[model samples]
Target chain A: MSSDVLVSVRGLEVHFPVRGEGIRKKGAGVLRAVDGVDLDILRGETLGLVGESGCGKSTLGNAVLRLIPSTGGSVHFAGTDVTSVGGKGLRELRRRAGMVFQDPFASLDPRRTVAQTVSEPLEVHGLRSGRRERAARVGELLELVGLDPAVAGRYPHEFSGGQRQRVGIARALAGEPDFLVCDEAIASLDVSVQAQVLNLLRRLQKQLGLTLLFISHDLSAVRHISDRIAVMYLGRIVEIGPASAVGSDPQMPYTQALLSAVPLPHPALERERKRIVLRGDVPSPSAVPSGCRFRTRCPYVFEPCDDVDPALQPAGAAGQQAACHLHGVVGTPVERTPEGVTAEP
Target chain B: MGARSGAPRGSEPASAVTAGTAPVLEVEDLRVRLRTPRGPADVVNGLSYTVGPGETVAVVGESGSGKSVSVLALLGLLPARVATVTGRAVLQGEDLLTMKPERLRQVRGPGAGMVFQDPMTSLNPVLTVGRQLVEGIRAHGDVSKEAARSRAADLLGEVGLPDPKGALDRYPHELSGGMRQRVVIAIALSNSPALLIADEATTALDVTVQAQIIDLIENLQADRGTGVIWITHDLGVVAGIADRVLVMYGGRCVEDGTVDDVLERPAHPYTRGLLGALPDLARPAVDGVVPDLATVPGTPPAPTDLPEGCVFWPRCPVRGDARCEHEQPPLVQIQGLDRHFGPSGLPHRAATWCTEPTSDTGLPASGTGSTALGGDR
Candidate 1:
């Protein structure tokens, strides 16, 4: 309910119905993609959401933006309840918020030119008057994203993967949205080009004071662009904190395992570091394990982990919280003081 | 052990594969020209390198850099009708380039096994996992169906698959992405090939799963002394698994050296740019300071229309002069600060290229040089 909070999500859930098995029952079961989750995005800051595939990171992002219908809970954006809005109100909500998808090729219309694609948002919201003014705005949007306005005539196929992504960004910014949800925006790009797009997003955020939600599986990239980090696991936020604290001193066991899984670019560090490789692949959402969803794969699972699912609590660090039963355990290492300052390891 | 007993060993003859001596696979001046409508486009131009026994040489490059194409050409994977590959590729003292189709087919499975990028596409959808693995094993060996099936189950167990026997009956779709990749690896190692060509093998998998697969490959390589060619764009994976690194740009080996030398003190501008572009997880994030990721400006040149001089000159931040535009720089040994010049009378090595921006230019040296990197380390 803070004034500075751009998007506030509370117990957001997105569940899909499992289709019929063979010729039997049509609605066999429910696949809880994004089971109860809560998060907040502050104005003008990039909150990175990271998790492996099937972890519901993308589902949560989509639900927040109202692109996907949520099964339960609510998403409030800029003082308006996003989940309840409809018709004009929903269109207005969309105008104030936009989403940039992962695959540039699939997200963009192949037949449309850069200008046509970008100008659609303006036309949808009735932002600018006349064809000429919308065209001018499209030019500005392209320029803002570091693409030459001259390329406006070019089709999506003509531009490279990175350039196509830039066009997507331009389209997203066409409505002049205050909040941007980039779902794995740079995941499909090359490393060098990923850097370019990441820098561009940061620059645009600063220039426009835009609140951004960057959802990606690339931990290094999430660390680079995000001011705050949120780690999702099996449709829930397990750890949330300042990027620095969460990345370096992760409180949750899952976060620790995820960070350790990342291969450092430095050979010496890579060779020296010992990684905690998790045991198995993520369990199917339809048949999620009882109690904590991560209990099946948790390396340090204890008795309580399988009995009581932990909730996010202050991890004794500034703006840091983790959902873990072993937080107070003697040998768990991540103990917090009364003031919420984490004890140094 | 029936599969292993009857089949030719994936490793070369003991005399041919002496560790640390001669390389198991030596590719010299390898060129791959694809027959497009416009003309013959040289996808892989004059590439050369070697994979030593029990050694892992990581080939790093962005998409369309010919890292995969060059290796495919070397292995005769490219269709003969579409690609004209000319090179001297000697595998265990035998010329692979000129070898007959029949001989190459015989060498492919037991001699050299390949694991491709997408595990889903690499596997047969209709075929059960056990059937595929068994078929792959029997392809290179004269073994009974039951023996092959047993060997396939053993291979599955070796890859750390849970309920290995149960997984054998499941189809590709029944497995997770990570499990599919493990199945691919198991098939690749069915005959214990001496040379393993993994082309972005784990790129499609999640980081956690990627780590497990990498460990599996490392353990297998350690046991069998298999020479591995890991083609990937991910620098982090290259740093983790490779003994030596080959940074490819525009179908050429831009830089080649030990992992420490290439990664820590990257000589080539492209390599430096690649390293710089990667967001370092090791570096702590600082508040109020926006760390601008250093990026290489232009896209890689098209194969048909490459630059007249250095392929990288167009995007090189420290490109020297008109000479760089006219002549290609050769790879010169860079042990010391002593400059080694090519026939064009200009320093050709990346080490020399690194020094050119600082030593000669009166302008304060930009941050891509070895001096800036040394401070970073």
Candidate 2:
């Protein structure tokens, strides 16, 4: 993996104000969606960001691409501050970085043909000059994502879920971006079809040498394509390391729990696996736990974990880092599950 | 093939489903044809399976493989005008498909319960959890509202929902996805149903929450002797929970066997392909590069335009076999009755022409696609 940083993020934070407009009155609080996240993407490596539903993984990914506004911190793309740029520079950043959204059904327009949908980026970025050129480029992009260009005339409704995802990929790659963020790209696809889309993304990444951020709730899919994996919780990344190192010998208790929770496909192995059943649900983002967000459900939570949130440091495994008190980086490592510990909502 | 896997499950007789007790739910020749805008579509075709007491029968398939439709059809959840369901579904000695509307409604709560994929949709938005739970309980019997209310709280407590009493007063929107799912499970178990149909129930939750919910369901099933029909596309979950696995393709049970007989020695080519597509976590990346996933080449056939013969023939990689193209293959026995399996008398059966050719078959590695998933399983 290349050490040259493609995208450098420092203390990136994205907070959403909970509004009680029409429906049930939600208490007024700032939901710290992406809170103080620091990460770096290698020049051509695929980094998988994994977490649960409300972990702000998607928010962090959007912040990296400047798709959504952030509350605090800075995002530097290609050695330049992406947060400061506006107008043409911002548009240029958008062109350089493409985002493939989660839902393919909602991402594409029902009225627009596949060609029109794919060429929208090319038109906006003014990549291909003429209509004929744009159509040709769209065809190339379609082929790049393993779609037949002949179906370019058809509407989005005519295609299957997997095919619609391929069209979405084609649109995301229209501007010839150096960086791509696939936010739950294959989550909506079927089990068999997910692999097809994942394979296509891996192939495209290799062919173009594009820096990729594949964000998904599914750890198995994330582990498959990512060279490096980052395990996020609530808002912060608890662990980041080489995919094999993290997937195999994870240092962080949260990472360990997350890995153990994933059900294996082998019956013998699955039955024999030691599953760490977390007590309660993920704490609400609006009311995140005092110090470490994961401490509420962490079985190995210590006194230091409740006071001082440990920052990412060199963990036990090589090239792996974890932000946990159990690392003994500062506090005593809590090896056993604390007794009589129960978290309340 | 390492067929003698010790099966490991026969030891715990109390919790584990026994060999030959009468099935809680027996579905035979089940078919559901829907009247879509295009035309009449056969969503489910000739499905057969049985779920004994405390048995977890997992129906594994892709999205439109009729996993969900079959369950919905049996429960009479599909709109009557749009659906044509013809099946023999005996749930707790009652025919779900042929029963009258009122009888089916009566059977839904105590006889058979369903926990759907989306918690937001399954629950009543306007009604509180306590009210809904009590209403379900009172509808079945002449219990007092106060008694039903306490019972509702007890059900919530049983489901491991925190502050069960306080949670009953709160709305579904107030709870997290995992919490909402717990409430749904609590309601599903309110009447102590003999069978529970969870259609992609934990798909919405994260891995950790999913595990908790799974454990809860397993424990509940063990205590109540409730047969579970778990409909999910996740092979990982099917591995952990299922006593019997039914691999569905194009609305048909392509393969049905014990976890070992299917997962370890997958008979049907489709099952093999499905297992091949999964990414095993135990697998290590080579030089920081994970191996390429093996994808089944094409998407599933749409219900409106299903193939004339074998539904999988259009995408089945094992092509040149003449029997595979024009004729629908029946469930052929892949392996005879294995004494090791906890649930007895059920052999490994695959509805494909490829089951007989075990030696030198072009099928992918039987377990997960990875090398680490090979013999260790």
Candidate 3:
């Protein structure tokens, strides 16, 4: 693992047992939401995970934070392996990490005031001494997220969508965690309010020197806040590179298509740009395709793709890695293909 | 002109040149007030717009900005007991507001079809996709069951649904979100309505699927000359599909112009704020640094209790003048600009206001204590 890496995940997999009909077939099937995936998040940097729904980006994030139990693999956070920890050690692991959810309304306690919600973290961790001190800390946290300190008395229902999200942020920051996993934090917000929340998150990250794992399906929002982006397809990280590099020149076919699919705000550019629209919906996770999961919809699929699943390998640019057969390693194709193998697509 | 001449001819799209004549739907001074527990909330203020034949007018607004309510009022979709709708919606030369319920029902699917945001809510869970499509088709026209079924199959295929035959038997829940959306689109285009209203149609689907649906709509519009009203908050999608853009804020059209004019050189403060707030993926990194997003300070006013004068005056950057505070700004047509502004000019127009331009150039930053935040991500 790199010295700068704050969170190191290796071969992480999360599988949920599928239930059948009413209640008869309890353990009928296994849905592998997050399959063999490896990622490294540098300290104080936002690593964005972008993919469509059911692609396991959220599962991967939850696994890293140990919010959900990982069926396989290891997640090393700070100096301890999160997967191996339990009881007191697990509580310690949680103290150093926090999660911000997608829906602020659902995530927050409707009955609890903003202060109670924010102060609960302080109480759980036993961070601040005395009731007065904790109340003051709660106000400070609310202010940090650009909310009025007086708003600490109001309940979740009293605040707007943006204000409720700020309260959620304040609650997350109350723990003073080094690592934060924001799972589609702004997905539910309006466009105008979306920007405000994004700006706030960025400011908070820089001010607190917090390491963040910002997972979202919205490519534009992810690109705006992420230092490095990892494009997930099915359950794997198909491409990982600097935000600018990936945004400008994506090596993976899935990454390329995902970027192209995003509609640019400018009308002229939107009309001019050609889109590589993927065929068919994303296949069910339980019945994932063999070899390469993306080959079913991949535009540049070849014979090698069906027979062998490509692993993340170095690409043309530094600090960039792509899991694709097109970027032949060492100026030669990695897999020896028979004649006419490339003509299949 | 109570003519049914512009009904579906063939699958081939109508010519773009024909779009210049009569607009498919013309709305004038549309207002919808909902009797909520709090009070009579004016959801849709006096709004007017026209969708020309084969033209796509994208109505962009945040939630509760009356974008959806305005369309619902035009279509008579809002509940009569709860909503008091007053508008003149002339569709194909007939005013929808004055039309009888029976006449309006005939015009709904055949005259103006609609595709909603959530496909699940729009579709029946128990009924098969085939049955629903056929029902919609046969409801408007005098078609046999066999003919309707075949048309449904063709509609499914046209929307790019895989295995149209097998999909017809499957229920709505059996299909994926994208597939269900396609089914919704298929049903919407069953009778080839003159006007198609898609309210956040692709908002629920994945980006890749959204692209596909967008392409399908554009293609269908081209072949059928269907005037589309795409109501959505997504500026990016609006840029790609809309011929003209209508920006709604605080239950009114703050700005209206061509997609190029509005997006590239926005004149209204709210429109400018919306464009500025968006995080552009195509935006070049400034000296290898991610810029902080500019935000419109303060939340939108409550619909029931909107501030006097300009609806956006509370959040407007150049909002210190007495005229702006006491009197609402009329939607003035900008001469030679090929666009319309609420009251002010571009940032250059801000220079004429009381406050001096704070920024280096004529573009005056909003004086509402709003900061342009940028940071290296």
Distance from true location, Cα of B173 in model 1, Å: 0.6
lDDT of 1 by residue, A77-179 (tens): 9888999889898999889899999999999999999899999989989999899999889889989999999999999999999999999999999898999
Candidate 2, residue A282: lDDT: 80
lDDT of 3 by residue, A181-249 (tens): 999999999988999999999999999999999999999999999999999988889999999888888
Interface RMSD of each: 6.9, 6.0, 7.2
Query: Which residues of candidate 2, in runs, are more than 4 Å off?
Result: A1-3, A19-28, A331-345, B1-18, B286-288, B335-345, B356-377
TM-score of each: 0.91, 0.92, 0.92
**Chain B TM-score of model 3, please?**
0.87
Model 3: DockQ vs. true structure: 0.54
Model 1 superposed RMSD (Cα): 6.1
RMSD of 3: 6.3
Candidate 2 lDDT over A183-249, as tens digits, reads 9999988878888899989999999999999999888888898989999998999999988888888
Kindly list the per-residue Cα lDDT of model 3 for residues B1-377, writing each as its tens digit.
00111122112322352345888888999988999999989888888888888888899999989999999888888899999988799999999998999999999998999999999899999999999999999999999999999999988888888789888999999999988998999899998899999999999988888887888888778878889999999999998888778998888888787776677766666777788799888785889887887678989988899878888888877666666666766665544322223222321111112222133211345454221211211
Model 1 chain A worst lDDT run, 10 consecutive residues: A336-345
- Clash totals for all models, in order? 3, 0, 5
The 10-residue segment of model 3 chain B with minimum total lDDT is B1-10
